[model samples]
Target: MITLLIIAAALVGIIFGVAAILPNDGYGHRPVPRSHVDSYPTHNPFL
Candidate 1:
C-alpha cells in the first residue's frame, strides 16, 4: 500500500511539473526554445 501511494504521488508530481512549464495561449505570448536562448545578445542594455 505504501509503494502504491508513493507511485501515485510521483505521478501527480510529474503532471504538475509538466503543467508548470507548458505555455499558455494568448496575445503577446512567445515561446522561446532552449536552443535559441544563446542566440540572444547578452550585452543589450534593455535586458
Candidate 2:
C-alpha cells in the first residue's frame, strides 16, 4: 500500500511538471518567438 502511494505521488508530480512546461510553445499570449530575438543582428540595423 505504501509503495502504491509513492507511485501515485510520483505520477501526480510528473503530470504537474509536464502540464506546467507544455504551455510555453506560443500558448497564444507570449510575445515574439525567442529564437528570432536571439538571432537578431548584433548592431542596430537602422544605425
lDDT of 2 by residue, 1-47 (tens): 99999888777666544533555423444334443223333322221
Candidate 1, 1-47: lDDT as tens digits: 99999888777666544533556212234435543223433322212
- Residue pairs clashing in model 1 are none
Model 2 per-residue lDDT at 10: 75
Tell me model 1's lDDT, rounded to 2 decimals: 0.46
Which is the leading candidate under TM-score? 1
Q: Which stretches of candidate 1 lie over 4 Å from their true place?
A: 25-47
TM-score to true structure, per model: 0.49, 0.48
lDDT on C-alpha atoms for all candidate structures: 0.46, 0.46
